[model samples]
Target: MKSKSFKRYFILLYPFLMLITLVLVALISNISLNDILMAAAKPLTSPFYRLSFIKEFLIVGLLSVAMNLSLSMGEMNFSLEGIFHMAVFLSALVAIYFANFFIIIVLVPIVLYFLWQVPKKVSRGDGNKLIISSLIFNYLILGAINYLVYTFFSDENISSAVTKDFAFALDMKLGVAIAVASLVAFIIFAVKTSLVTKLKIIKDAPSILTSTGTEIKKEKRAIDLCLTLLTSVAAFLYLFLNYNRFSLQSFTGYGFDAITVTLLARGDFKKLAYPAILITYIRLLSLVMQTEFSFVSSVMYLMQGVLIFISILEARDDRNY
Candidate 1:
């Protein structure tokens, strides 16, 4: 009962907490209040800005959906950033020689194969172990990314060859459509399938299920594959939306943000959209800060760390509930 109350209160208080954090960050960074206000108001004040916000929202929104699938099943997939990056980079390479449609064709099988191979090496443990293993997997992907960057990819080749020849606004709209469909599919799967019940048991009482001859490991892998599948589609659409905007500099923090969004929404599919909008707005505000105040990315990361810590606490409380 106490756990339930605390979770409810925390969810209600989260937006205010984020608002306070932003204000504190602004004050500490010596940024102007007016600048922050203007940044917050941009999406509301302009159609182009609104559309741009929605475009960015779709990327992280779909990602949260994907990540939540694994997270709700007691997995924290830090490897999603690596998976998303790999998908975009490899597909962009294929795009150099083939049509965009062919990229989708190639991505699906590659993602499936990668997910298939992942469990062979990294045994799925509990949540913390899953996090550590995912991080390990992520770093491995990063190592490969570094080698590929050195050997194959560059701004000149990627930009001139892979980024053009596509309609940006059209692809953005297509991404939105696909994201809506994914949400519907997620709802049906949750409500209509027995997998949801099985996943709950797998998370809470794996031994009981195993005693009944349930395939716990197989069930977990199935969720992981579903996660990869959703993330792969999101990756391709994200690449289409921001084709020239990426680099091999570092893992884009979109994956981490997605996890945070899912946590903040408490893995509720209906609530996920709300936090996605808020997070995306906060993210855009951070970009504006970067330009206007020379705000450091590390500061934003620190704030996100706090949010994640709190959300993890809430997740723990949920287990108690």
Candidate 2:
């Protein structure tokens, strides 16, 4: 009986597993893996390069996993992209005015609270409602920024039109390092918290836990809030600090990448880390491919989105084992 049950479960999981394998194979084949490996193995490589890549991969993966976990608990937080852009704007503003680490740290939470609360208020506890409200919020904020940029910050003298003084103090390397450190600290704290532990129990025995009703609801809210706040902070740091370096020229592609990372991890942080790293590498590889072939990058994004959509649908239908 036990063997039959296990076999049945494996059969159900096979297609999903195969899909993941195929994505990996396709991504791997697109890049010059051997050449990249050889380049990395060179003795003259910079320490910053090695450390920054690991830091960036972990931070992005951590944020994606955190957001997915909040969504799993039915928290409507559709403001991630907006919050990310806001974080960049706020960071730039703060860095310009203050340029002190302590001030930025103090302000980050306050900014995140406002960002988190907007969706909570608008959604009135509905996830879909929150998503819609957040999307609207994103556009409104973007328009405001563009207006400000053009009216005051536009250097009539310079071609780019951006204010030179308004740039963020921290670059990609420092931003990624700070984000990775914060993620590590959050993971440590989360492990010690009662909410995650209680959720584990409830997840293990929903019927028994649901009998208590109030306790389960409280535990669920605690977990969702914690995850949402953490993810918001991480995304904010990534977008804010790196925005100037990477063109905010197109956010649609990055937004899709965020969705793919979230789906691939299935809201599990540990599993998310590996996939995040793989996805980042795939993206880097995609850049190389784009230089050689005009349409490969567009094809890569389409493939990623389709795979994630299928994965989410399949996960919804299958019972968690």
Q: Among these predicted structures, which one has the highest lDDT? A: 1
lDDT of 1 by residue, 244-314 (tens): 44455433678777877787776666688777888788776666566667775555456666777665565
lDDT tens digits, residues 6-80, model 2? Answer: 544543443345335544554566645564444334322646445445545644565576666554554435455
Candidate 1, superposed: residue stretches over 4 Å from native: 106-109, 112-126, 157-169, 189-192, 242-245, 248-251, 309-321
Instruction: Identify the leading candidate in terms of TM-score.
Output: 1
**TM-score quality measure for candidate 2:** 0.64
Clashes of 2: 1
lDDT of each: 0.67, 0.54
Question: What TM-score would each prediction reach against the true structure?
Answer: 0.82, 0.64
TM-score of 1: 0.82
Residue 208, model 2, lDDT: 77
